[model samples]
Each structure stands twice: as C-alpha cells, then as structure tokens.
Target chain A: MTTAQLLGQDPGWLIAVKAVMVFAICVLSTLMAVWTERRVLAKMQLRTGPNRVGPAGLLQSLSDGVKLALKEDIIPAAADKVVFIIAPIIATAMCFMSFAVIPMTGVVNLFGRKTALQLTDLPVGVLYILAVTSIGVYGVVLAGWSSGSTYPLLGGLRSSAQVISYEVAMGLSLVAVFIYAGSMSTADIVGSQHQHLWNAIVLFPSFVIYVISMVGETNRAPFDLAEAEGELVGGFHTEYSSLKFALFFLAEYVNIIAVSALASTLFLGGWHALPGLGFTEQWLGGWFTLIWFFAKVNFFFFIFMWLRGSLPRLRYDQFMKFGWKVLIPVSLIWILIVASLRVLQQEGAPRSAILAFAAGVVIIVMAISSLVERNKEKVRSADLPEGEAPNFPVPSLPNVQSINVSGGK
Target chain B: MLTIQTPEAVMFWFLAPLAVISAIGMLLVKKAVHSALLLAWVMITLAIFYIAQDALFLGIVQIVVYTGAVMMLFLFILMLVGVDASDSLTETIRGLRPIAITAALGFGGLLVSLIGRATLGREAAGLVDANSEGNVQALAKLLFSTYVWPFEVVSALLITAALGAMVLAHHQRSVPRATQREQAIARFRGASLGSAAGLPNPGVFARHNAVDVPALLPDGSAAPNSISATLKARGDMLESTQFELSEVDNTVTEEK
Candidate 1:
C-alpha cells in the first residue's frame, strides 16, 4: 500500500486482519523470550538450557507450558481463592492488551485493502499503555497479598515499589518523545520518525533513560527485586503452581517483548526504511518493517539476557535508591533540557548558540554546585563522630527463616 | 427502551437480580471492608446500567475515579488497621426476621413504584444532559464553561478529603512527649560521663521506664504461640503480622 492510502483506508475486514497479526506477534515473541532467557542463563552457568526441547530449545517455552498445565494443580489452603485466580487473569489479559496499541508496521495492505498494522490505535495510545502497565502491577500486588503467605506478601510489596519507581523514570523519559511528536499515540509517534533519523539520534538522553526504564518496567535482571529467591523465595507467585504459575511466566515474557518493542518503535525508525537503505521500498515495506522491528526487539532481548547472566541482583534498598535518586532526577533534568532546547528550536534560536548556552550554563552550575558541596561535606565530616555509623533501620525480620530442600520437581 | 416479558423476568432477569443481589451482598457482608468493596461493585454495575441508558461519561468516571481511587482509600485504611470478618460486630436480628420483613416491604414498594412510573416521558424529563452529547470532551467543556465554579470547588473538596485522611492515619506517641526522648538521651550521655560517682538520676525516670528490648524471637525458632493466646485473653489485639503464634497456648489450662 502507498503511504497515502495507508494513512486513511481501513474499511472493515482490514481491521480484523491487523488484529490477528498483532495477536500472532505477541504469541510468537513470548515464545522467543522464554527460549532466549533460558538458553542465555544456562550458558552463563555453564549448563544446557532446554537443548532437548526443540532445535536448541526453539519450542522450549511451548513445551514447558504444556508440562506445567499437565502437572498437578494445588491451591494453598490459606490463599484468598478468588483474588488468587483473578490476579494472573488480570496480569495476562492486560499484558495482551498492550499489543493492541503497539504498531509493528506503519500500515499494510491486506489482500486489496489497507489498514494500520496495530489492532486499535487510540488518540492516547501511549497513555493507554502506561495505564494498563500501571494496573498490571496490581496483579503482582494482589497475587502476593491473596497468597496469604509471608514471602509472597513481601515479594508483592517489593514488586509494586520497584515498578512504581521505575515507571516514574519511564514516564519522564517519554516526555521528550511526546514533546517531539506532539502526541502520545504510538502510531503517530512512529509516523513522526519517518525521516532518515529517529528520536534515538535527536533525543539520545531520553533514549538511554527509556532503555533503563523498560528493563526495570519488565522486572528484568539487576532490577528483579520482587522475585529474588535468595531474599523472598519465588516472590509473588510463590504459592501458585501448575498452569496458574505458567500464566504469570507467560505474562512476564510478553511484557518484555511489548516493552522492548515500544522502545524500538519510539526510538528507532519504526517501519521507516533507514536512510540510504534499500529494504523500505513499497513492495517490501510491510514485510520489511516486521523484520526491522524484530531485529531491534531481538537486540534488546539479547541485552536483557546478557544482563541477567552477567550481573548480580541489586540489593532492594540500593535498587530503590538507584531508581528514585539517580534515574528519576537525571531523567527529569534531561527532559527539562530537551524541552528548553525544543522550545528554542521552535522559536528559531540558532543551533550553535543554544548548544553553547546550554554547555556554559551546565559548567557554571557544576562549578558553583561543587564549591557548595565541598563546604557541606566539610561541615558534615566535622559534625560526625569519628567512626559512628549513621543511624538507620535495623534490617531484621521479626520471625523469619530460610529453608531450601533440594529436589528436582 | 425495549421491555421484556419472559418466564424468568419477575424472579431473575437482566440487570434486576444483579442489582438486587449486589445491593443485598453489600449490606450482609461480614467485614466492613468487604462491605465497602461490595458497595463499590454495586455502584459499578449501576454505572453499567447508566451506560446502557447512554450515560457514557458518567459510567467511565464512576469506575475511574470512584472505584479506582476512592475505593483504594477505603482499602488502604482497612489494610493499615488490619480489620477483617472475625472482628465484625454481629447484629441482634437473626433467623431472617428483619431481612424477610425488609425484602417483602422493598419488593412491594419497588413494584408499586415501577408500575406507577413506567411512562417514557417521566424518564425523558429525568434524563440528564438533554441539550448535548455526553462524551468526555463535551462534558469537560460543559464542566469548564457552565460549571466552572463547581469545578474549582471540587479541587477544594479533594484537598480537604486528602488532609482529613492524613490526619486520621497519623499515630502520635500518646505515652511520652517528644522532649522526653531528647531528655532520655541526654540523661544517658550524662550518666556515662560521670562514672566517678554512682548517682541515681531523677531525670532518667522521666523517660518512663523505657525498656530497651532486643529482637523478641531469635533466628530459626518458631514464634511462641503462647504469647498470642496471652494477648488474646488480656484483650490485646494481634498486629495482623504474617503468622506469629503467641506463647500463651501452653499456659491456657494453667491460667484457667
């Protein structure tokens, strides 16, 4: 389909076709996420990760789902039965709903008809994703709460805090994107990235913030505080077993794909052919965008798996401190800078003058701040006792113990 | 606008039974928190009923603001105190005496009310927003233009509710003053300094016999269930922590 037709041409069945394609994308990507996570994690520990399931465990996630479903289902006697059931349902369903707004390609011709590749693009699609994702945390929160167990409750609270902290940073990161595109809708944002370069080049700081935030958003490693087994065993889904547990697992990977895809679509030229690139011609457009999206998504998936294998899980307090103190403040300042520059650019401020002014302001602020900080540090050191530890909470669980019985279930 | 006449219509059909059932459930639930939750659910279904009558904006806001945010405030308070079904105060009326009488009266009253007000023009007058389409943007414009004063007043209402909630949730040290804490610390420091003379300090007593107790249960031991029973008998409430049985269970027969 020509770009003109693509902009405005979905009659009836085209909508259905696009919806089917999105459904397929979610299912396929979720499978790959499972395989990618396991294989990489196994390699990190010098062990095989489901090499027996399919060729190098290609169908590993599917096989695991089948096995999990067939296993004996157990509900903890103490669990809140209805809430426990509803938690996973809410999580998985909300996760699936995100794909509805995720634009895989611009617009594709479906057998003599043209429509947007996404299922349904709302005017506030980005906010819609944000809304659904925020609500998704309730699934984890209630899962932990309704489990009526100590570990799960702690896990749930940790997850909720983790998601909240990072989501704030994530929202801050997207402010730049919204400023550039002038809309929060995913499709419109993608269309804005139609030129040779995407927001990743123009708004690299925002891009970096978004990358960090998405990792935290999906509960990926180094930030997976909620499901830290060495701390809170199995985290929120500790009590869930069999098929119910599988649903949570499925939701996590699908969310990973969705989050990564969002980062790709927003930052990378989503479906738009690269400058001097041959793959974006009209004949190859629909299929090519699909490939382009997957390539960027897989690149992120690799990073996620690599981090999981490479880094140790952050301490809960440190994890929280990083999100709130470091990520949030930095991203907020970056967004302000971006907005200021954008405002100047719109008002016809010369690029060099704006850059020079921004740099000079940064240096002056840094120098003055450094001098003030030194003075405060000197005073703080003088006031503090020689070797006394600063007062803080005693991190002691009132009546808790860890027990791990070794068995292959 | 279509009226149905079917076999199940009188007993249970469409929104009627759901509305009645949820309303009943809201009143009868044992936990105050769950009753509020049930009340929220009833309001949600009624909102859906409004949507069916084309009041879309009202339906959405009812769920979004009321169910999502306000119900959370109620749940948050419930969680802070950990009140549940077991702590609920039961009523005097039993054996369906009150419920049966209320249901009979309600049924008769509702039937009479429905028969008397079945005409369409009565609802036509009662229907809100006869002048405009009630979509979100339109409603927002109407709110800002026609109801601008009330709109600003609503912000005041929200702020007032927030402050009230904060005041209620806060717990102060009723036993001792803030100055007493500093005084206790100062007395301890003074006592440490003057080791040459053994002196009983009167200022030390001002801290109110504050026992510096270490962690009650050491690691790897089950919490003593006996203490919980002791607390129960003494009319002290449990903290609703994750399962720590008290030490009073073994002493129960002895105490009796």
Candidate 2:
C-alpha cells in the first residue's frame, strides 16, 4: 500500500500514539542536537565541552532545562504582558508543527497495526511546513516589539526583514523540486526518488539553494544577523528570562532539526537507505528506515555546526543582497530550465538533443555570470585609483611637547 | 444537504465561533498590534475551514500568502510605526463616523445575503473527483489551460504593482551624501578642536576602570565628556574627588 493509504487506515489510538511519538522524538532530538553542537563546536575550537553532568555530558541539556525553569522569570515593566508571554509559545509550537508532515520511516508495524511513521500527510505537505515556519517568525517579531526595549526591537525588525527576504528565495528554490516531483506532498516527493537518482543529484542547483536558504530560514550561523551577539544583545529575547528564553532556544534548535529533516525528505530521498544498503530497510519490519532518515538529518545538522564553528556572521546588507540578487534570480532561472526539461522529456525528445539543450543553457548561464562579475570588477576599479589607498577619515593626533629628560651640558 | 463528517463538523463548530469573535476583536482592539494579531487569528481559522473542506491547497496557500507573508508584513510595519499607535476617536470629518458605520452595515448585509442565496438549498459538491489526480495537479491543469490568460494577466498586474511601489518609494538624494573624508574635514575645520583628538576614554587615570567614573583632566578636574551621556543624565556617575591623590597618603610603609 502507498504511504498515504496506510496513513489513512491508522486507528485513532495509533494516530494518538504517533503524535506523542513525534513530539517526543522532536524534543529528544533537540536535546541531542544542542549537545552535539556544543561538543562539535568545542572540538573545532580546541576545548573540552560540558563533561560533568552525565557521561560525556549527555544530560547537560536536561540540567540546563531544569536550571532555567527554576530561575527567576523577569517581565519588564514596559513590556506588553500578554504578547510577551505568548511569543515563545508561538515560536516553539510552530517549530514542532512542521514535523507533522515529515516522514520519518516507511510502513512499520506498531501494536500489530501497519502505519507510516508520520503524524499526518496533507496534500500540500511541504507548503504546510513553509507556512508554519513563516508564522514562527511572529515569535521573534512580537517578542522584540513587546519587550519595549531598543535592542530587542531592533533585533526583531532585522529578523522580520531577514526572514521575509530569505523566505522568497527558499520558496522559489522549492519550485524546482515541485516541478520535478509534480507534487507538493512530502511523501510523494520522497516516493518519486525511490530506486532513482536523488533530487540532490538531478536537481543539484535547487538542492544547493535550498541548503543555503534553510540555514538562513532557521537564522543560523553566518546568516544569524537577527541575534548577532556582538550587536543586538540576545536579539528579540533580550528581555526574556527563565522558561520564556528557554522556549526560544528550544524553538531555534527544533527549527534547525525540522529544516534538516525537510532537506533530507525533499533532496536526500527521505527514509530510503543508502545506495547499496537497501536490504537494511527491510530489516526490523521497516523500522530500520528511521535510521537512514536520521542519518541524513544528522549529516545536515553537522553542516550547521561546521558553519557555526567556522564562518563569521555575514554583514546584513551583504546577506540581503545575496538573497535577492543571487539566490532568488538563480532559483527562478533554474525553475524555468527544469520546467522546460520536464516538458521535453514528456514529449519524448531525443536524449542527445536534451543533453545539447541543457549544455547550451549552462554555457549561456556561465557567460552571463562572467559578464556580471566583470562588470562588478570594473565598478570596483573605477571607484578608486590604482596603487592608491582609499581615503578614510582619521582623527588627528594630540600634539605633545618633547620632554627634555637629559640635562643640558 | 451538505454531508458533514463528524470530525470536520466538530472542528468547524469549535473554531467558527472563535473566528467570528477574533474578527470582531480585530475591530475592537485599541492597539494596532493586538488588532493585527486578532486578524491573524481570524485568517488561521479560515485556513482551517478550507482544509476541513478538502481544499488543502487553497488552505495552505491562504496560510502561506496571508498569515505568513501578508500578516507578517503588517506586523513588521506595525512594529516600525510603533505598536502602541492608535487612531484618535475624534472624527476629523463631520458625520464621517455615521457614514462609515452605515456603509459597513450595508456592505456586510450585501455580502451575507449574496452568500446565503448562493449556498442555500444546494448540496455541496465535494472535491473527490477534482482531486483524484491530486489537488495540486488538478489546480495546475486548470491554471495553465483554462485560466491561463487570466493567470498571466494577474501576474503581469502583480509585477506592475511592485514596479509602482518601487517608483513611489525611490527618491533621489537632494544633496550628495557627505563622504567620510569630507565629514572629517568639516569636523576639524568647522568647530573647536576639543574633540579633534577624539573623545577622552572614560575612567582615564581613575582608581577603577568603571565607565561611570569621569576621566581626570590635566588640571585635576573631572572631564564630563569622558563619561557616557546616559550615565551622567541618570546621575550614576561616581564622585571623582574620592579617588584623587590628596584623599590617600602616598607614604610607603613596609610590612612588619
């Protein structure tokens, strides 16, 4: 049976169980992700991270959660009380909601009933995820505004603009996938990749764009201008304390995991085993597929940590410019190419002809890009004379009289 | 009669009242942010209703386009304009309030009557066949084939609107922006040279490195400019005299 039909046959009790399981998995994975991030970042930085809580500090997140819950929760006097409290809940809830459509495993037996390990599969599953994540920004925006502080407000504004800009690129990037798969449903998209080349290989540009946009979408590392510590003082959560702050933290990590899972689903073939390990998918009544799904997710998560440890945060204007000028336009062009190719394949065009057309498109793109690069170079050179330092304002030094320490002869 | 399933019926019954209440609250809320939130709630409930009716594609689009992008832009503007900004109750135009109330009532009545007449006594046709090949595919087939011209026109109109917005927002600078070098020259030549060397560091030559301590000038007086303007305004600056050389004996004493 197809995953959708299997999902439809799930009993109420089984659905409830699956819901609880998804929630537990999300929360547990968030904890592990936090630990992994810290340990990985520390290793990159030449330090030992969190070794005192449990074995290898596996329980450190739990301890931190408790500590946060026990600490004082301060509400600034100037804050809008209701929205301030609701913001974190909105952020965290939206993060978890994105997981509802993500397929974690193939059909598996649980309590003597067959079902797919997903909460629900809407027809427009991927769109649902995008919508939920878009709403998630309200948490940060409202948190910043309701705090009634300068820094948080600035952080919130930056976050709103940043997310809106990247979201356009992100959405456009997904268009290529939808065109190739011919469905917006996550399960269908994954099933389309079975025994075939992964979308990551066939539609490589879209995958690359999706990866970059996902990082920006989740406000991570180089694109994390929203909570730039050196500038905004914790960003939108500047005034939040205790559990409220922890919720935002949890929301962030969960959002990372959610987007990673989505990347796996859309581009990495979801719960499919590796190229040579198809047999493992049949083991354990298909429950072993979960391992493959999570492995792909962890691969993406590691990239997140690698970026966080190595890359510096991008300047806000440069980031916005890249999103709008580079990512969005490239995605639009890629979508056009993919759609045309899809039409050519449907019309039974000759293979050699298709290859020639694709190659011609690539050459044109390269030529255009080189021309743009040369234009930029010309502009840069024209802005300043060769072999001369660009003039910048420098403060004049204070005049000091020379002190005659040596006595005159 | 429209056949309503148990679960969908339950959800509609539960959310319908909440949606109506929030829509009303959107109008009643004093704060712009609160009003925006209420309208967002209303939009969400409407999306849910769409999904329950098997229009999953439309429902999600409603959420993505409205609650996600449009409402977010609204909230972004509200935050920028100040969250507490509210319209004055006093009407600027004479009899404008009564006219507005009457116009709203007439509009609402017209909409209710139109919808009631259209949907009344009709069996609701479900989307089972339309969605047989999948909702997105069906929608795309119609969009590209039957409604292709209108779709293209709508897209063109959207692009035109965006271009119009850009034209409206774009402004030529009335004067050339001052470059850093020009700004520096003006700073040095236009005014006194007290700040020509740069503002003095706070807590300079002080007992501690706290920012609240004003720097000691060459003549032993506190330099007010050295301390932060915020600290000075808040009366948080420490007494500079307490840390002066005369307050403590400088005689070296050996420990026994």
RMSD of every candidate to native, in Å, equals 13.4, 5.1
Candidate 2, residue A242: how far the Cα is off, in Å: 1.2
DockQ list for all candidates? 0.05, 0.36
Model 2 lDDT tens row, B127-242: 78788887878888999999999999999999999999999999999999876555666556644555766777653345655788877655446778988889989999997777
Reproduced native contacts, each prediction: 0.00, 0.49
lDDT of 1 by residue, B1-256 (tens): 4454464354335766777887898788766655665676676676666555556556655654565445644654554454233553555566666788899999999998887787634664434455254344566677899999989999999899989988999898768653533554454444242322223222211222112111132222322332344555666543322234444232323464
* Tens-digit lDDT track of model 2 for A1-409: 7678889998899999999999999999999999999999999999999888999999998999999999999999999999999999999999999999999999889999988899888778999999999889889899999998989999999988888888899899899998898788899999998857899999999999999999998889989998999999889899999999999999999999999999999999999998888899999999999999999999999999999999999998889989999999999999999999999999999999899999999899889989999998885565332232222322222353233333351
lDDT of 1 by residue, A1-409 (tens): 4333454457566777776777777887788778878888898889988888778879877887789999998888888787789889878887888888777765566676556577765555676677667667767877887787889878877787787678888888998898898766687788888743699998898899899989888888988888998988899999999988988998998898888888888898666666666456355636667777788888888888998889988877777878889889888888778788878989999989899969976898699789989998885565322332222222233333332232332
Number of the top candidate by lDDT? Answer: 2
Chain B alone, candidate 2, TM-score of: 0.67
Of candidate 1 chain A, the 10-residue stretch with the lowest lDDT total is A387-396
